[model samples]
Target: MDFFAYLTRFYLPFAFFVMGESMQGISIKPGILVLVGNKQLEIIDSVSASKIRARDLTTGEVLLISPGEIEFELKKAAPMSNPNSGQTERTSLIESANEADIELASDRYDVLLPIAGKRPISKKDMIQCTEALKLSASQVYRLLDKLDTNIGPLSLLPQRRGRVKGVKLIEASAEDTIQEIIDQHYDGPGITYQEIFEKVKEQCLAKSIPVPSEATVSNRLRERNPRALMAKKYGSKAASQEFEVRGGKVLPEEPLELIQIDHAEVDCIIVDSEHRQPLIRPWVTLAIDVYTRVILGLYLSLSHPSTMSVALCISHAILPKERWLKLIGMPDGEYPFYGVPKRVHVDNAKEFKSKNLEDSCRKYDIKLTWRPKGVPHNGAHIERYVGTLMTRVHMLPGTTMSSTKNRRHYKSEQHAAMSFSELREWLIREVEIYHKTTHSELKCSPLHKWESHFKSKNGRFSYPSIVDDQKRLLIDFMPFKKRTIGRDGVKLHTIDYYSPTLKRFNIGSRCIARYDPEAINKIWVLPEGEQNYIEIGYADLRLPNATLSEFKRAGAKLRADSKRRVPAAEVFKLIRKNDALVNSAVACTKEMRRMRERKKTRLTDSGHPLNEKNAQQVKMSTSPSPDYSVKPRPYDIEE
Candidate 1:
């Protein structure tokens, strides 16, 4: 975009990052909670992303995005500012207490927080308990007023005590005192809850089941809790504003169009069985339906970020192009393939903003959305998704192997590589699993909603909702590059390339280059008119061969009088020309002899081999012994 254009688009939108309301203390690495509505149609991402003003990456039933996606999800949920948007306990559910329910809520909180959490109490239960009990929302306060269950910082159930070792109990309950001792000691003896209860109650008999009345007490006391729990008292809640973003302002929620696509590189290394040490970077492509916070499609590859990979990813995965898109990750799908998104959101990755991709998107009426510069967190939705990638796509079968995607090696140590097929299988499996598994961060399993969504939509996935035709999908864009043939006729980065026509035509000019990195060195170059690819660069192309005959001939003729050095060049030249190389060869040989004679001074009268030189310098070669028995032969023989 030009100055004004940039101002109208990226720069203007980015200006929000500086807004007090925009950069509201959000962090690049913000805590996120992806929660699913009860209806399962509405997906919400509650971000602590106080930095940028944006929402979840996907919301449309399903989506396939890039690898290295990090998404936080609430295993449990609660309400946010919007009643439509509520928070849930990612770990457990907590509900506020009603008026009468305040005491109950407090009781529940006291009982649950130590183990489960507040929301474990149902919402209807909260409303009814509060209404019936006439407890205000000040549940904790009300709880403290009534429960005889008092301990510092914590009000336990009047029922029993948590036996924390080295911890003293005030207003001790008989059960608690014994339980504390039991908790501290018990490895040697298995003390069932029943046994503990019986002993504490000063009762006897072995079949240690809790008395039905005290079952709740025993159950609450025995349950193990995570170190943290939801607050019994309500924290400040977010307002329920149905803000629709438009013209740098919040408006009514409607016209959910733009979709975001980006690539997230995981900290994991790309490896397979073949190349143990992966040097190239493999990335995953992800597309999110902004309005729905759904992952539409994902593609993982051991290739660089290129138009081809992006195009192929979208082509193979994302289905039903009825949805109108402003920009897609790629430009345009090849003919016969349909379905195009309205807009594609991506970073300034070269592959994303590439001209080819741009042209394709333009051809298909897709709009490209670029995030603000230097504000990566601006795309926090996608960034969050990237965090979950592990090198080992799945846990190694019955082994203690560290995840390849996850780092187990010393960060400083190099890793081995994996074969292309192995890598491919791993990637495919990861994508498959991702589509199937409930997103660890997406409050609910996206796939579950996906099938239902596809079914309810009548299999229509297009904008305005049209029936999807997956078979019609086409290539939107493909990565391309130009390379020159070296004089050696070998392509760089290519170990093997060949085209009988190229060698026959013997013409080397600019040509399109394509190669499968997994295949390594095996490349194909397409000439302007050629329909097929020509592989170049092989073992034969790289090796150098002249001749050794000349050296052998020279050694056969011991030159006694000559003045040139080792005469390697002259010897080679004579061998090729078949000229009177004798004189030249003799000169070279004689020179070598003279140099050897000069360098050697340690000689015995009998001219025995000397060891005065460093032991490493001497070399012995196998040869026939001089025929002294018949007649001594000259050390340098003339053939």
Candidate 2:
């Protein structure tokens, strides 16, 4: 509902802005909140305050608020996961760069080499030399064969067209070639030999100077300066994902030596479309700096939330001001950032494996390290946050559901997923609030520490200038699918997948699969995906737990259910009846026997339990195996 209508219904004294209490029912958890009384407001509860906020209720005027909002806002004791990308940047660095006396750039490397080093070379050393000289890729490979002075006396340069300037190629003493490098913009971005050739041809054609045929002119140039005629294509453009952090004065540390990163999937499942119920939410990617205990980046996405997202999160959260700008090649007014971190802590998620993200770290000399799989404890810091989210936000009553409409009948249903948009917003607000408040993990508010640590009285420490290289971190998509193994193959969302991987796990078993974003030929088995994809494990299936009342009633209805003619119904009835019989008022005497047998059995068959023959002396009372429903009891109501 709109704010006006909501305020009117509540009969609130004054208009108030609600920061994140938009949700209808998030106040089911425990928390102490402030409330107004006959005179003034008062602080409520939370055993022994611990840096958490609580206004001086006795001094301020009473502020009337709903109980639900109070609990929802205050009772928010659960853990939270947020995107790691640093959203803030320094503006002062930009002003400084623009006002700097001179533009910063590496000196041209051409001055370092001898004239003999110029040749058509294609060796690794030659490529390095070309790069060192600030030469283009075309220049690099063209001079490959001429890498060493010992190889040849002359070197090759990539060919290009140019125009004649003063002296014409044909008329000016066939011994020499003359051309002007006109900026046609056609020979590519830089000034090259091609432009001079094109200029020479045009100038000769227009003037009285005799122009030679294209072939004769070319042959003359090649014969006179063959080493400069080596042709090379421009190198193919490629990009990778990266995140950067630099230790202050404070130098960056070695890879993984000082940094480790970890990530987690959000607890709530998100709707595929606002109209449809949520598919399951994928992972929540996070990167942390181990030493500082700072979150480097956080990313929330519906796709599997790959390695790139994690890297992007790290990129968003922190950057080494100078290196980031240098790597990106940004202009003065563009990007600004605070200090970078020394190390990054992460889990085994592939996003951390991003070659692109790694390259970014390498460029800036930042370290990136990851933990092995199945070791949640290793990433305990982030795991603690993820756990809190699961217990508080995800498990909250009437909070998450297939959709808004689904919540209306939520009491009847076991649980529901959340909409993606809603989930994203919740995470952001939660994180922002988390940063605002102090945390147990860092023993202080993250924002307070981060700002205090990096910010100066004048302004924030040097900030990064975003470059194309910095922005080149690739984001990719991997569509989801669901399945279970059937005799014929693995069935995903009713679709059959017959692969060698599935054969090992076999049919009749459900599995989740996602295609690789980089390569379509391979697929990955996941624990869960957005709704349309296969749900992986038992918990992912959203299996409903049997309530205490349901269990009791199911046992009591055994007699009536046994009369059902349907075999399946009858079977359930018999099973229920047996459960009751084992624990019936008449079976109190049998309990003692069952107990003795349970205690005596040291071991049993591979997959089955112990026999229940010892539960009763009556030969007819025997059952083949231990009862699935029965449990040890100290007292028997039957007695």
Candidate 3:
């Protein structure tokens, strides 16, 4: 029998977080009302660490049970109905409140803000709250407890002192219970609403509560947010593509007004940097200006698309690219496209929705908007450009040619000659070519269109939106975490950071810590209520700088080997071991590829028994390479 077969025998209780730092998730204390299966219960007392004494809201019977027996729910507040109108008592309080009530609530909110979520408020803090609000210690505790009912300033609003005559109370409805079950079960897998309704009936029967009608359940399911439902059933990307409106292209007024960023897997196999062995196709994250159709910035990596990829792409798009172009060994090449876009449009991908990306965009006053949930045409600008780029990619050696049908009889891996760095350099040169080529829609080169917009007219030119503090711009783009500054500074990913500047801030104050994923040996900490961040390095500065990728891979290996709580030192040791192993493999692979290439070259030179025509074809395909050399000149000069 399945575990759920016995689920009906016992009721699911509301889960609670124990009063300690060791426990995680939302906290539940005494006096709070929670649902056990379908029945409402008030948390009356903590009888033991695992068991709690709760009173049944209906029967007023006090019973002791483990907190684990309950399920956590987002909607737990019991509705209190008015006698005349059947609406919750405090539902409209925030909106319908008088000016006097709003002002009073605001004052109370300020006084309690510091200690609102802090459990077991310190004696010193309790005295201060009493002094500031002119309320007793018990009153302060009661007010804080009220926050558990509903987490808002409305929870602190003035209410009637006593229950009014003919007033009615309502518990969590049977319809709501059915809806919760539907939300949980009717997604991802093929679970029907009928089956969900049956399960609800079983649970309700066990808990001795009235079951909701199937029609009620159906109505609830229909009322779910369509986008949210589709996202759960399929995926965020699919939901966006299906529901987004395919309106006509809305062009930006000028350059850098609207930029679109998206990732695509290059349709060609590439080789490794050291071994030149055929590696998996790399992914390129590209950002393009909508108005001019100019490539703003791009990041190429072997890793899949992630928050780091988007962050790097945005940073590249904002900063001047002269140094980057030179670093890729294209010193003479020109790529002038760089500026902070007024708005950036992206698909409904998880990386784009990350808090770090949102915060960084907010700081720069850049609008980060998601393309609508349904239509592919909504993101046509980026998609069309990617399609055009991939068409050119098919012309290169070792090209996969978009699909398997087009790649028939061709062994891409065998002909794969370009290394990752070589591919990157080729991509940069290709971008330059793309900018010079006449666009089908514009009837002129993208470079020309871009130049005309920023060119001096009436002794004035539209300068790009450049940031003054370039260093801070990059730092803001990095992934960040929130942690409290403790006695030993702050700990993130099991690593300690410390600095003298941290001493000025109060101990146990929560601060935002942003770190460079490339080298996380140091971090920048933004203390609470402060505008700028202070640099903090590892407590043990001797520790080697480790990339975020290495840390994740090492941590994963440890977890797979059943080491749940491996120390930071052990993980670093594993990272070093992994590096050495890769280096050793690189040497062996290089020698093997060298021997194979020599045999192929000899065959071509001697005209072996293999078909002469086929041999010639292979030679032609493999012999010719692009001329990467470009004469140094100003970007304004035409080819």
Candidate 4:
């Protein structure tokens, strides 16, 4: 009998079947941590055929959930196997292999992945792969067999030909002596390979072991990472500069095959619309298509870089720009670039690594990749583009000019004239101009390059898939929360939300909810086992819309005032009051400055009360009001 039948016969209380069929629970094992929406939960135990008990890591609350609630596996548990079995063997093999062997194995694995499991691999494909890997057909088949046994790069590493790995020809003492000499002197400045070889030989002899041949010593010295050796001899910066030039470039064949996203604080200061006074330097997130070098989408905001900025930038990139341009009071057809990219490359910023970004990309089958940590050159294209764009910004009215020395005697704040919305419009117009201007590398405008790629060849034009649901796309990219529905509504961060459609779900059923960071008054809920999302607005409609930051600030103010149980309405009221105070404060400051100016003028006036005594001491004729009635005097009576 199978495992299920054996369990059923032995344990009568265990329910292993549902509807006369074996019902296996989720594949996730107990004790694994999973991300369900924004909460991290550790699985405790399987409770039923379809449910598992878990504990919330943040709140330390225990609850039961189904497989559908899991959004991502934070840590993957290893397979059940013997400690000394295949896992251990593979691990040891990988440890024994060097970096070059592993790189070669990885390349071979990638080449063979296309036809990994195909039976009787076609001669044409086999020949192509063999040619690419520079391997014989029989050797390729052997590697394929090894792959079937162990599906990893370790299985493909080139096997040692003569002596087995870790069974060295030289004695352990001699090997240690060579390594010591190499560490002490081999990487020094002006050291030669012959000198390193001679030193290794001398050390090996001194250790009283049979001296290893010069060839072996030279091979050991060569085995060190060239970059690491260079860094040890010179400096890390010089080594980096030497290796920064890449042999290959990012050359995507299609428009949306590759895209890059990055954030930068704008050089120019922006003012508030009402006050027309300098507010702050705003941040801008830009998304560019690598293939055509076109600016696909951009988001400008006064807030700092965060997951919301990334989500909004992605949303803007995916959705068509016509509606956005119209909303910004620009020509709708100015920017036509829009589509889901096949792969998105970003820096190793926490915002780029957010689970929200991963979920959204996974939902659309888009690949998200990050550059290696501390490797800024991987993002060279975007960085250079940002620099070029900032150069144009330096021409603006309130530009800070990239550095303090460059901005000497330039009062950015006092000269600030453009409002936030006005700056946004200016940026859009500048983007249009950039798209039409010729690029130094491309020798053609970005827009022209984009159009040329889409031009028809053989009656077929290249076009990317357009997003079907714009609102849903935006909601999918926003940060999510998992909460159980209740009789009242969903309470998120002390705010209660309700909608009539929420009545369909069970009282305590957990659901996924996403909120726009710009507006905390509303959220979209994907009810349990439901595909469509229902809109949930504030339970108290009297509360006005406020940003997440504003709400947080209001909550902090209430807590500082020693108020407990701060209601949503009360928090929003404080937000409104704070906003009013900010606006009034600006106006009050302007008025106070004007009043001070008038006071200074009055103090300096010649006819001031304090100066009247000094004026009386002077000649009275000089101080007397020149009588307009004596205007009859002419040049003839000048005497």
Candidate 5:
């Protein structure tokens, strides 16, 4: 018999059924624990059709038991006074049959004849059994007929209540039309069941077929495959999340096996490097290893988060930290971690979902996973790390704190003490401190955890080696754009870039240019179908320190100042001359006003506040120190 059929027949009294064994009105399958007699027993094997091989749960003794005996024991041990007594018993049965693929069986075994003895069932007994099971007299007669016959109660157990056959009320054609309407309109915004019903009515009337009622239509729509319906109406993304099986929490066994990258605007204000004027808050992108919770790399920039920032952060993560540490003036061992991660988990931000990042990851054989939107727990590790880092940033001068309410009456710009370079160094030191400090979740320093994991004898720990060509790898991760080589030069953002290597290429031929937006001094150009890129400098080399943001800002300032369009060269010149003054005038004027106020309120002698005239008189009265000339100090000095 089929599994379900067998379940409906022999194992109907019990709540659960396993394939290949039966015991005490319950199917005791292999690997299931059950209460047999006074002791719990695990069914090890099905020895025969009527007997099961079971091992004692406590004593480890093995024995055989009939299916009837197991059922009797289960009944005797069942609680008698619980409100949900039946449900509790069923739940217990199900809990015991925890083996995979077990099926729930019918609970109508009370109607079956007892299999223990061959005594014929009496008419009174048959009537009593039928009444107890709520079965008809004809069914009772059928059971009686099966006594001593091959066709027994087991043979009749598979029957169920329902029409064996029926004539269609709603024709298949009408049904198909209703389904089509549902498919077309269900996903549309603000769609409703009434609208769907109206559409189905129209289709049915036009086709001259009987229209199903609104209730029937609603039922059919509800019965449609949930996953398929969701995919059609909402989107595949929603459907996958709703129906897809999610993986459990994963802890990587090896470092660099999985990493998470995210960006956060540092909580404090910082001054510009050249102008020393307070600028907007800088952004910091961090890449952290999942296994040891160690920070792999970090990139700090004035620009907002973008695909370029993600690329730069990941590139830094893959490269050696020695040069970077020395360049940033950090100690050698401050950031010891480096290697290409096998996978990177990121949020669904446009920058992280960009084609450039996807392509770069694919090229490096790295798996890039975007966490589902609104599901913060999936990326909780990095999110928590960002929060922890921001807590430290809040303690610095000029911090905006957590919110506007928290920052009430505080001037982040006025209180700002660190320049951009200084902030960078401070962040590095903070990151070092974080590495040395014990993590709340890990209960040990990240550096210590990383070192111990590697040094352990367990084969679970593994180390990912660094890349060979670090420079080439960094270049590969930089932002790229396509341009054609021309006789004059390749123009990028109104600036001409040229290289001696371009002389070999034909004019009008296309090439790819890779650049760092923060430093527009030079770009790397790759010829079509070539693996290597040649370095190209801007045609106007004097503006070597010009960045993309500076150029844009310069253009904006010129437009605002002149109130008219001007040549690129004029704008560039204006930028070079007045870049520092462009945004510093208001701040400088405020500083100057404050200084004048201090001068005006100066205190003089006798603890009295001095006005302008009194201060001048006091300044004039103060005598300068005298300098006495030495008159040929020694007698023999004129040799």
Candidate 6:
């Protein structure tokens, strides 16, 4: 076997040092004392490929032996009888050797030595030493001449060949002026050497000083380190792009140890849930496990991603998937991968760095790490996943593709075939399929890998359960604001929220209010030092389906329509009026369509076809629930 192979197969202790020339001729070197069987031997040298020369300690005789024939332990080096004396002797020997070499070289060159309180060497003695050293007479004479000029021993050594000093055509003052001009103009957009040169020439003319040629200034700038120049002129961003430093790769040891979360805009257009008309692409928030490259959880919504989206995605990742799967109409299956990550890597987006997010992570014992700004590769795994998912989305009917050039001549809105609900279901199925398919790097399906991780003995998968109630978790993630309770109610975004319980609190007292952005009909109010929250409903409770975004949109529309700053109360009133009108129109349109369909159906001579009216009456009696189209008031909002 080769020496490396041998070392790999055997465990070598720290004391042993192995040295072998090729694999064939392996043997211990001279001066190493070792034991072979019952014999103690001092290695002399290698005689052949299989034979080693060693002196038998007992017999005091040399012998040749095969290395494989013996098992041995290397004898430890003997300690000095007197450590201080040994150290002193070693120091003295080193000094003596240095002096000897120096004296020999000087004598060979017939050079005069300068020793303190010692007579210099005579010429005859130097000549004799030079002749004894066997150096050529001419060489010795030339060395002596160099020494006579006070040249040091180190000076005699050869040096690398290169220009030690560059030729300077401009004076120091002119060079400084040129450098100043370059520094001043370097950060300017599309700045050129000619511009800086012209500036320098103009300055020289104004000062009545000699100006250097343009070539000289260009050479000076070019000679400067490009990276340093770029940094000095343009900034670190430019320098970083021109000169990149590869960072160490992060490889987590176990699943769920580290997770990366990011937000991406999905590239396909889907119809809105309420309007049932094609809307802009939705933003998707995704969380992925760094170790196994498994997608933990994702959130899809028409609204732009926010801290709430991040929190919701994290909550989904930590919770079990059984409930979510059933809600999405998927077959009975387990999404067993879930746990509170030890560390979460995210970008420096405002939502990622929010105080609430930081506090929540601290509460859960998860360390939050923000990748350095402009370093997208730090979170490359999640970025790549987003890109891969977007590629699949591009294959859908209403894809915007990636860029405008790719989307040229294609109208995504007109080609859209899926509603928001249908798109969500499709995404869910795609995610499931992605979990089952083999990962390019993992060599196994993410689901299979996750299952194996749980089953493995060394996995030590810990199930992280929510510490607080689900409602509390949701409340913690909700957007919070400090407000002073007024005589009327607590107003947020111009919408008044009130509760009978709030009336007990003193007016003008500061309190905390938390509300879901997606559902602004009700908010939870907790007075200062209070342990529980009182639910507060909107003053105009009829607009229970209004969202925070919708309220803001209404306000903006009102302002634009009036061509002036509209009051919050007026905006709220207009929003309700517009919502009522739209709902009434939608209801009337649906009724008209139903009546047209009924008229088209051929009825017998009777008012209805064969007892169909009776059957319809019976069905209506069995299901007497109110129309789900009407917004339901939150009764629990009141005290």
Q: Which model scores highest in TM-score? A: 4
What would you estimate as the lDDT of candidate 5? 0.68
Which scores greater on TM-score, model 4 or model 6? Answer: 4
Candidate 2 CA-lDDT value: 0.40
Better by lDDT, candidate 6 or 5: 5
Listed in order, each prediction's TM-score against the native is 0.32, 0.29, 0.52, 0.55, 0.52, 0.53
* lDDT score, candidate 4: 0.74
lDDT of 5 by residue, 98-164 (tens): 2222221223333453521223456777667767767786765564443321221233333335653
Q: What is the C-alpha lDDT of each candidate?
A: 0.40, 0.40, 0.73, 0.74, 0.68, 0.67
Model 1, 1-639: lDDT tens digits are 232331132111110000111122222333333322321112333333332222333333442222123232332322222222211211111122123422333445434233222333456655654565466646533553432211111222232346743353333454454555345432222445565555444431232523233463365344533121111111111111112222352221222255567775433444323223343344667765544345555655544556655675555334542221112211242211223567777888787878767775775577876887755555655565554444343243211133444334444114434433344445544544555667655466545544454454466543334324332222224444576554555454322345455665444676776543222223456666665556453434322112122244543452333543433334434433433342245333433332222222111101111111222233343453332224446566553
> Where's the lowest-lDDT run of ten residues in candidate 1?
12-21
- As a whole number from 0 to 100, the lDDT of residue 504 in candidate 6 is 82
Candidate 6 lDDT tens digits, 1-639:
343332232221222211212323334678876566766677889999999898876577898888885554332321221225434433343333444444444343233323111123347755664667576656544544443111223222222366534667568888888888877776644678898889999988887779989998898789878887788767777787769786788699877889999998889887544444565677789999988788897777666788778877887777666656654555465466677788999999988888888887887788999999887778989999998899899999889999999999999878977755577677777877888999999899988777776664876654555445545555666678889899888987767888888878899988988876765767888788888778787776545345576678888898788898776667667766765665567444533332222222111111111223434565568764343436767778683
| Order of the predicted models by TM-score, top scorer first | 4, 6, 5, 3, 1, 2
Q: Report the lDDT tens digits of candidate 4 across residue range 497-583.
A: 999988878899889988866667678888888989898888877676666766887788888897687777778888767556654
TM-score of candidate 6 relative to the true fold? 0.53
Candidate 4 Cα deviation (angstroms), residue 553: 2.3
Q: Which segments of candidate 3 are over 4 A away from where they belong?
A: 1-248, 458-462, 499-506, 559-564, 585-639
Q: Model 3 over residues 1-639: C-alpha lDDT tens digits?
A: 232322221122213221222134546688766667766677888988999898776677898867776554323444321122212333455345665665665567668867764666899999999999899999998887665323344557677677854342323666556767876777774667788788888877877788777776676677788788788877887787778665565788999999999999999888755556786687899999999999999987666788867887988889887766654456898898899899999999998988779888988889999987765576888999999999989988889988999999999989888866678878988999999999999999999999999988785666676777765776788789989999989898888899999999899898989886655777889988998889887776546556676687788889889758877777877866655565556355643444333323223322111123445575568764322333446576564
Listed per model in order, the count of residue pairs whose N, CA or C atoms clash below 3 Å is 116, 83, 12, 0, 5, 0
Q: Mind giving the per-residue lDDT tens digits that candidate 2 earns over 157-226? A: 2222576333443455322335332222223335454555666666766664665565664544444422
What ordering of candidates by lDDT runs from best to worst?
4, 3, 5, 6, 1, 2
